[model samples]
Target chain A: MAALQSIKQNCKKVMCIGRNYADHVKELNNQRPKQPFFFLKPPSSILLPDEGPVLRPAGVNMHFEVELGLVIGKQVKDIKAEKDEDALQYIDSYLLTIDMTGRNVQEEAKKRGLPWSIAKGYDTFCPIAGPIAKSKITDMHNVEIYLKVNGETKQEDNTELMLFRIPRQLSDISQVMTLEPGDVVLTGTPKGVGPVTSGDVMEAGMRINGKEVEEAHIKVE
Target chain B: MAALQSIKQNCKKVMCIGRNYADHVKELNNQRPKQPFFFLKPPSSILLPDEGPVLRPAGVNMHFEVELGLVIGKQVKDIKAEKDEDALQYIDSYLLTIDMTGRNVQEEAKKRGLPWSIAKGYDTFCPIAGPIAKSKITDMHNVEIYLKVNGETKQEDNTELMLFRIPRQLSDISQVMTLEPGDVVLTGTPKGVGPVTSGDVMEAGMRINGKEVEEAHIKVE
Candidate 1:
């Protein structure tokens, strides 16, 4: 197996999609958003493959949602949705990554109308795979993403099911903040998200045209 | 006047306090939070003092919030509240910064139980002055913070009014995410935050023991 490429040191931010998959939205009982909703995780939250175990915070219900990660290749700001094709030119690569969440804490925050920082921004909460060049995936809308916990498949879906596609997401986000080189965007997650416990081994992977493009593994501590 | 030192390049993450001042909370008609509420802005959002005209996004009601900024000098993780005094040791400097916000967007997000990224993470939304060594201020808890728009005083208060002081905020945040060198923490704003229109000149400053310590100005474009 090849060594996993870490985006930790160079990554400036982790922009995440919230409730982008229809099934996942239904499962979580969340309203379908009119526009793409996003939150952020600090670069310090990134846990590289070489890093040993993913620490599960005590007394919190930690859940895992695997999503496709896009690495921005150039600077982008105030990009219009109609010019999404030009915005696509800013993407450099893709990979599989986990958006770890403290589900219970998030629910509490939502109830109180507070920001979701502590629920989604803990250290080692984001685990990513080695990068696969953007050219490797010819169809951005049809790739498959999956996650398995303790060898049991939990989440499996195709990018075709996303409520908001990559181009629109990038364009919309660029309109808000500039996307610089090495900044990451997690393109939402599918259904079947569930809890993970200490001593569990998790695997997340991506496939294009039925060919495995990238995968990563991490053990819970 | 000396040239303003820029932390924009080296800054990793910006952790912000929400509703930390009682007067500000009342001014916004928000309930007092039992614990500190935080949101994040990307490093790319940072605009240095000398960086000319702060661009105002069209169709958004942009607001200015002046707060005390803390620059972490050492690594911190999983620190306890009782050890907050030790956590303060990691802070090397302070500055006055604008936590620029999109008021309408944030209200909409709060109503939908969504994150405040787009509301608080827009490019050039965070304008910071050059850092002041922590040693310069004899009393961190009693420093004065003030902001002016078009030469009219808008916000004025002392750090003594903050519900969650610097040590508690830093210690609480470290328990979730590691505070690395160059990471900044905006310790919430005081009352009198309001809108900024094009052509407006905004100035924010801080004083310790009635002596001006740091101040910076930017024109709204």
Candidate 2:
């Protein structure tokens, strides 16, 4: 498969799942949610590999969560659980991405029962590596996703750890909002999420069939 | 100025302010936020007048919020309050828009400290009328924004009631997220917000200089 081109212009929204891993939920000291919870990031927040350094908002403790990304190839709405397999046809490609968050600000918003836009929607808050066609991965469940900061492994997990897998997650989200072509869905990250600061070098990647399929190098500014 | 053309394709994101009006805060029984809080909707959620009827999700209570929409004409980031006047140059046009929401879903999400994307981002959730050039209004603060359900006025308020005016709101938002050309800012809704059912007709408009500068007629499915 050829390398995936930048989908910034085609991408309309970045939908993300929250607390999809039991370890991640326990690490954050958060109760298990009854259902798959989702949030959004504007297209402007997408930082491609060649887009330069990621801007770290001054004085804010920003954290990073690495996850697998699914790019929709067709429009879908009101997808049903029974037809989850059919929904997979709509996914054109997959990539490795990061969900950057402002920890203190998000905590404050949660305490006040406010929205999470300011905490999660900052510029350069989302970064993605080159994409691989969906056909490249023979077994989605066996893929390994990991991240390293400053040459030290920070997060290491597999897709089998996700609480809500791709099919169910996509179906649940489509029931609320239509999934259009180029829209990216970030399946929740696993445990070991931590904060990043200025001048940090981060590497995230996905391994399929014992080979690196997708990877991204991000420099914090 | 000619009737404002539909900006659905040009709009990158629909950014909204919450609890910006004192009366609205009292009506919802929400405390006045010390700082402006915001949420987002995808550009795909935008439904133009010519696009047809607004689809109401079954089993969910839907509500309408009329607001003045600012269409960004230039890119801006980290704008300061002192430079707010200059920020106005980036706003090329204004229009009337409805922030359709799933109230029940939103309330539930808020209680659980979850994101509000599902509640506020259903397809056809944002209905926008044609655009009115910014120069058409002599004083943005004095413009009247109102909504009528089936020809009966439900909400009537002036922009002067907003807690954070355009300049300050823009400055504050740009500090966190980059405001790109064609992006929109919904300055928040006034009091008299209520739910609407299928088969209802919604009329929302903005009165500038005692004249209806922009208005939209939406039919609920």
Candidate 3:
């Protein structure tokens, strides 16, 4: 893994998995999906670490869920995911990202069977950090993901707790939507999700064996 | 536009409107939304004019939705749409496109309150044609849109019937998701949308005053 390019320039779509962690599903009172469930965030919503603050829409409850972001390295479709290694080859790098949500809007959309684009796609909503190559982490399933707001830990979880792991998610998603190089996949968030108001600062990161591999600092305004 | 580049290279995301026509709403038994409703289609699903074919997944009921595609000329956000004129400046070109959907998958997702990504994000799901410059169409709202499957008309309607016109859709959508250069906004489809299977050839296009301005020839396989 050498120096990587900026995601803002290379990425196309942000394919995201939802409810991959059972506890997070329980926390949201959402039914655990039988198969891998997913949604998408537009590339327009991608905000680099130094781009600017994430604007909290007026009259909307904004929340943050930190997760590991996989950068697809090649064009792949219908990948067989009998083993994690099969899907791992397609990932060239990773990032730490915050999937900011309009919680109030999302709740209404969910209840009314509406698409979540508006709820999940405000400008600067997705703040990203690190394209740490896949080689940085020896085991994809053994890393720790954490997020803090105003220096208070709100979310901390291990990837091992994921209900539908990366391999299955990639394989299932690729079967329907072709995974192209430069495309990103946000592996679902963990439990302990909460809201963040204006003037709040969020610090999210990924760690391997207690060593911080990547982190993102974001502000809400 | 002077012979525009391929959409697969220039496009970032396909922001689409849903239930924008009264007749289409009645046919689907969906309530007319008070505001503009939108969803996203990844750039990966974009199939250019010379691109091969639209592949229908096994056991999926695929339906064709012909629409007027607006190509954003420049980056715009929070566009005011008290009138369509206020938003028309953002559009540089237009396209005739079909929003292929997995009707069965969508119906189930709608029933379970799930996201519609899988139902709408399949490869070759978005087939497009024509970058006919904005100058070609005298009135955006007065254009005629129609689609035929195997030479039989399945959908036919006029943009004048749109519940929420383009300007309003763009203005409302830009308020949430920033529209960028090359990003496309597919105005919702009309009534008489039916199933398209393997070996069906879909010819969809837009017209003004009964004269064809643009057309798309898509083969399903």
Candidate 4:
């Protein structure tokens, strides 16, 4: 029998960015897009109550790519990219997400025409940290998402530089999917995404619009 | 507060195939994998209801893909490309699913190195037909998944020519993500994927092993 269900911090889908940061784009030698780019990660990929070094699943060389997140409050669909504010009628709040990737597997898989899911879809691959209410922020743009290892910042970038702003991307993204309440859209990351060995203590911080809201930390085994 | 819930056919993830059918590989001039290839379609993509035609959301070239689905019965990870029996043991049941696609959006999105959730993760994109018990199947290797429009079969293929058998593909897919109860793994469709226009009738059927177990038909509006 199908179980009845309701929303508890209900996140409908987790969408992510690709090559949004210029340095990351330059590092990738890729051109900017006329629109925002996206991919998906299973919600099961979340590592809640996370502790210690996260277990990297097999079949991919998982890497860490930190990013800003938008948690939608209502269903938004079919909005034009240029007029993203029209889609804002649906967004509820925001979040912080880590889009862990299996880089090697992805390179190989895409080359062979396979989808990147296996390379990125394992459980605990997408570790999310916050859903701070929308009212707590003043600037959605110009916020910074940074990562640190044992208190040493490793990667940092401001939302001001995103190739596609969150509101615009949200509008574009909603055109293809009906983002229900709680769905998280991980806006692309800034450069400095690299490999992390086991035994690393990591902290990811988010500055919504401008003010830092939350910081999530964990240690590697 | 979180909704108190129990899962029914609850799967942590649902991995799908872009083109696992032999004719499909041939048509695209793509070589079939000795190992089965898979991708992810978040649970949010599913349109679960009595019976309906999954919508072709805006800004997408939504296409239709017919597939036989495997439901995991046990938790499994790191399964080999060979161990057939062990692979079978990991599965709990089987179902028939229609993997709806936004073909144009997918191509455009990927060319930008974007993720596919926008193209594939739209709500109601996944239309499932059954939860047929494991005991009902006759032959996993030779069943047929047929897609028809207005009572004409547009896609019809026997599992015989699949590059990778179910056992092998399932095992390989589990290697990256731990398969949990109710999770689905779609064994690819055969050649003959085409577009579906409005006002069309779509039906999905399966011959588990050999005998027909479940089928559903819905008209597009």
Candidate 5:
């Protein structure tokens, strides 16, 4: 698959999910939110897609979350559920994402009910996998997230268990706003989330149709 | 004062506040939210620390939101309200922020419970003004936001009227995610919001102690 135009070589917005899964929310002591919460990470936060080393942040407790990332090929917005075909009009494209979290920071942010920008929006916080064709995937609604730290499985989940499904979120998010080309979406992360530290090599990848959409190894800097 | 190290020259995140003001909430037909609603604008959304026109994307209905911005000086987490003063121990400085919005996208995202990165995070969407001292500002709790478009006054409010307040938000946001230097906190816009079109010019600035901190002019692109 060719690289999506916007993310091919332009600025990308890393749109990510928070508390989209019930158990993850419970683990964090957060009540299931009425709405699916989202946050942003700067494009620079990304590791070059398909590259390795996971690039962990040193001196602090950091965690890993592997997610099914969807990159819009074209701008998508205000999509009606009935406009499934029309909704495709707004998809920028598809991609993979590693929504790394500062668990310590996340806990504090949730407690304050403050916007999680400061805690989540770091230069290397949002990492991408590849530009996959949305049509190539059979089940956009159901997908698995696999994360391993130093060859140990830490987090693994599927999209079906998400508190809010993708199409619904796409329509809901787009209605109030526009989803542009190269804009990435973090569908959500599953259970078994854990922490990583410096010198700890971690690999996270997502497989769809027996292909890896995301493959990354994080190393502490 | 010498420029504080707070402004990360390469800022990755622009965290924002929505309906932070009571009257502003009323203007939007919203009751004051129990929690302070926030969103993310990518670094591409930023203009500069000084005055400049926030570029308006073609064909979208965009609006102006005058806000105060803070530049965190260090990596901080678990900042509690009581320890906010300690949180200040890490902040390098603050600036004034103009949170430009794509009204349509924001509302749509809010309704669908999707993230607002797009509506808020477009290139050059976040305009900053007045570089001030982190140690200089007497109170992040109560600063003033004065805004105008094409020479017409649009919004005027004091941070004192904010429901969540600064230290509280700082503590809360820092706890959820780590805040690094140059990451900004846009305290949210006040009321009297409206749209601007191509060829419309926006001029905004802020003041502390009767001195201008920073200001900028934005023209639709």
Candidate 6:
């Protein structure tokens, strides 16, 4: 109920979901996953608010993916979603975050059957906004998320477009790794994901029921 | 340094090196990587000392890959390892750990270009022993590591076989994700990796200069 800020410190692991949106999957020419495709970015990759510019590493094609972040408030494991709904209880709050990725490096790793750590685990790779209390978000399933780079809108979509929604994502992940208090899960990004260059000012936010609730601003350097 | 016995509580992330040994690369039919191949396992996956049996999930071909774990003692980033040295200062201690893997799950994920989170990150997957102080380890690069399933040797090798040794591993990793105190690096596994079934007892240990230092026992259930 208090201001659950200090995301950079409270967070442990950043669990990420990929290919959860149809259009986004098509844009990347990836098969629509029958199950949730998961990966992780280290907490060291987090860049807190006012932490300064996000470094665009040399020879890297950095891409921006804005998504809803679920902050786990309790320790839960083996949560089952057996045609009923009990998975939402694990989520303490929500936030807006950018799952910054090094596209070129990621492609190479994928082709070689290697891990995607370096591609997504660089310092300043993950940037976040408000820990909008669970009480504030009326319906997380229908919330709107969008991203803008250099004053131009690039990605704009609603959570309704997500292939594997929040409850399923949380339930599935909990079956493998225990979700602890402060662990954050980045629900997959939506369509219109694109690249960001140095000196680019990127802005992203979340809106629930037409009310702007959370926002994040990051500059590339 | 005091006894850093509570590994599960103290650790934040487990950075694992893949394809770091010539024989291991050849055994897995993987090409030698020009650069370090990295991935991560969540802290929740850790099974501490005296913790019960390591659960082998149903339908999963759980395999054991014994490795030397390096515990980072200092916060380091962008560490440069030239022809000389200096990377060893970051390591606070060492340990023996089994990087339990779901071979079938991993193979499916790899073939599909998916992240190996679930394949390699199930609960009770990482079983470790000893935070042998850095002072006790005369030479981390030359120590021997071995593993036995049901009292039969499966993997036995020296750290000297690692294609990318410690200093290089720490330096290269720091360049991407800042290595914080208590963070661990599982310097890849060796050859002779094989599947472990239920009712199997795994005994693994480390030897420095032919003297036993750390040993871990895990029972499969």
Q: Pick the candidate with the highest lDDT.
A: 3
Give chain A TM for each model in order. Answer: 0.93, 0.93, 0.94, 0.85, 0.83, 0.94
Clashes of 5: 50
Per residue, candidate 1 scores C-alpha lDDT tens digits across A1-221 of: 12344467778899999999999999999998888889999998888877767778888899999998888888878666544366568887776789999999999888877888889998889988767766677777888888889889999899999999888898888888899888999999999999998888888787777877734333344
User: Under CAPRI classification, how is model 1 graded?
Assistant: high
TM-score of each: 0.94, 0.94, 0.96, 0.84, 0.59, 0.96
Candidate 2: where are CA atoms >4 Å away?
A: A1-5, A81-84, A214-221, B1-6, B81-84, B214-221
Worst-scoring 10-residue span by lDDT in model 1 chain A: A212-221
lDDT, residue A82, candidate 3: 65
Which of the two, 5 or 6, has more lDDT? 6
Candidates arranged by TM-score, highest first: 3, 6, 2, 1, 4, 5
Q: Rank the candidates by lDDT, best first.
A: 3, 6, 1, 2, 4, 5
DockQ of candidate 3 (2 decimals) = 0.82
Give the Å error, residue B214, model 3. 4.8
Which regions in candidate 3 have their CA more than 4 angstroms from the true location?
A1-5, A214-221, B2-5, B214-221
Which residue pairs collide, candidate 1?
Answer: none
Tens-place lDDT digits, model 2, residues B116-139: 888889888988876776667777
lDDT of 5 by residue, A31-74 (tens): 68796656676554666644445444444467777777776666
- Per-residue lDDT tens digits for candidate 3, residues A45-114, read 9988667788898999999999888888899999988677887899988878889999899888888888
lDDT tens digits by residue: candidate 4, A167-192: 67777676666676666678888888
Q: For each candidate, report its DockQ versus the true two-chain complex.
A: 0.80, 0.75, 0.82, 0.43, 0.16, 0.77
Q: Write the per-residue lDDT of candidate 3 for residues B114-178, one digit (tens) a residue.
A: 78888999999998887877777888899888888888989989999999988889888999988
**By summed lDDT, which 10 consecutive residues of candidate 3 chain A come out lowest?**
A212-221
True contacts kept of each: 0.74, 0.67, 0.79, 0.44, 0.20, 0.64
Best by DockQ: 3
